[model samples]
Target: MIAVLRTPRFLLRQPQLGDAELIARYLNDYDVAGNLARVPYPYHLSDAKAWLRTRVPGLPVEETNFSIELAGEGFAGHVGFHRGPQGPIIGYWLGKPFWGRGIMSEAVEASLDWFFSASAAPVVYSGVFHFNAASLAIQTKLGFTETGRSTLLCLARGAELEHIDTQLTRSVWKARHT
Candidate 1:
């Protein structure tokens, strides 16, 4: 079965058909989409539907995505890993209202613990837009170190931006947690 992870404040559950409206509502905000690479600026209901269709249940750890539902509230955002050519890449986004409350950090930590446990990957990768200080801090706090820099297309901004790439190896994660 696909896993549903729980943190003290949130539940990382699989994205469902019923979640499309909620996902669309939060992602429609430009501020929320601006920081993300793939999310479009005028995110629409159809986009949410397409995204939901892409989520394959029971896929390997690297191929899955999750809905970041608050303990009592509904969908706040999403966190997931995509299998890139080099390795598994982890990514996440939270609604603007949920920012500055350490929610993403908690949600990510819970997912990472599950990811690292389910896969034998030596390192997991993530990247942050140079201006997204909060995202960079989250990765750094979780022990991801700078791997390099790369330019990527930001659909929301309709341009290429330099991203700070970071990686966390199994050993680094273990050291930090233990």
Candidate 2:
């Protein structure tokens, strides 16, 4: 079983097969998918099923997926890290109804705490589409510095778009939170 990380308003739990339906419901929304780089528009139940089947709890934190669940509600979104071209990059998105609630910020902090505690990597990177201001703000508030920019394919947008790359090092993270 995966360990659960709790905050005041949310629980970051390992993604499970049972969550596929709820995951599909939230991800099918254009507003949610558009902000994500990999999620395809018109997301389907099959997509969620396949995605959930891949999440293995015992893996390193960088490869584990967390389903952001509200205290009383079901799945609200997702946050996790994957092996990016340069290093381990974190990524996340919320259901449209849950947007603007600062939930992602909390979820990310909890995830990063777990990640930095478990991994030896000195830095974690995240890239946001130029249009995703809310995400940019969340990363900025988390102490990630702007590293650079590049054009990347947006599966949802169906084109390559300019992305702002940002990174947070272990030393900076420790210093700020100390």
Per-model TM against the reference: 0.96, 0.96
Q: Please, what are the lDDT tens digits per residue for candidate 2 over residues 41-149?
A: 8899999999987886577667877899897788899998898777899999888889878999999999999888888989999979999999999999999999899
Residue 82, candidate 2: Cα error in Å is 0.6
Report the alpha-carbon TM-score of model 1 versus the true structure.
0.96
- Where does candidate 2 have its weakest 10-residue lDDT segment? 56-65
For this target, which candidate reaches the highest lDDT against the unseen true structure? 1
What is the Cα-based lDDT of residue 15 in candidate 2? 88
- List residue ranges in candidate 1 displaced over 4 A: none
